[model samples]
Target: MVDENAGAIITVFVLGVVTVLHLLGAVPARLVLIFGLFAVVLLLAIGLLVLGEIRDGMRDAR
Candidate 1:
């Protein structure tokens, strides 16, 4: 279970880094802003999913 979550966390982190790089002009596109927005949404979703997992774990511990 932990290994799976770790994979997801890493993926999200990498995606965020890629997004930042693109925002900084490493990636050229006519819709840079759109890419940024998609990145933000992906990050938010990953964060929320992780948060829920953590909360569930805490509840189980209690």
Candidate 2:
């Protein structure tokens, strides 16, 4: 079973790192925002896919 909190922790870490990099001028703000948006969409898609798989597994377990 996946630990649900792990995902939230990883998501927060990634965002924090990106924000720090942007503030440090390591990356352009516009580029960071675009990449962040893309990352969020990708994460959401993966989460939905995982949820579907879990739901199917539960249904089959019965």
Candidate 3:
């Protein structure tokens, strides 16, 4: 669970930073939305992959 949630935690942190930067007028809303979606999908994929590997490793060990 920790391994799986790690990606989500990072994604949320990154999105928060991006939102702040956008609010500060450092980035456009369109760019932020697009980039945010990409980041979310990528992060989720990575998280799932890591989780799968961890599960597999544990199962193999057992």
Candidate 4:
């Protein structure tokens, strides 16, 4: 649980920095959105799978 939270924290921190930079006009909006999507979809998904919180073929069963 702690390991998963650490990974999540790192992901969130990276995304937050990107969002802040975008708001400050240093990063493009499109890039920010792409970063957000990648972090949410790919990063989190794979991380959870690796951590065994999400098992195979159980994503939409709820």
Write one digit per residue (lDDT tens) for candidate 2, span 1-62.
25544765576578778889999988788877876786687678668878998899999999
For model 2, state the Cα shift of residue 57 in Å.
0.5
Q: Which candidate, 3 or 4, has the higher lDDT?
A: 3
Q: Give the per-residue lDDT digits (tens) of candidate 4, residues 1-62.
A: 56656777787788999999988999989988887887788566666667675454467575
For each candidate, give its TM-score against the true structure.
0.54, 0.62, 0.58, 0.59
In Å, residue 16's CA in model 1 sits off its true spot by 8.8
* Residue lDDT tens for model 1, 1-62: 56656756676566666667777988655355565566667667767888898999999998
Taking the tens digit of each residue's C-alpha lDDT, what string does model 3 give over 22-58?
9999988997898689777978787778889889999
| lDDT against the true structure, each candidate | 0.69, 0.76, 0.82, 0.77
C-alpha lDDT (0 to 100) for residue 11 of candidate 2: 67
Ranked candidates, highest lDDT first? 3, 4, 2, 1
lDDT for model 2, please: 0.76
Q: Which of the two candidates, 2 or 4, achieves a greater TM-score against the reference?
A: 2
Determine which window of 10 residues in candidate 1 has minimal summed lDDT. 27-36
Give model 4's TM-score versus the native structure: 0.59
Q: Candidate 1 at residue 62, lDDT? A: 89
Best candidate (score: lDDT): 3
How far out, in Å, is residue 55 in model 2? 1.2
Candidate 3 or 2, higher lDDT = 3
**Candidate 2 deviation (Cα RMSD):** 3.5
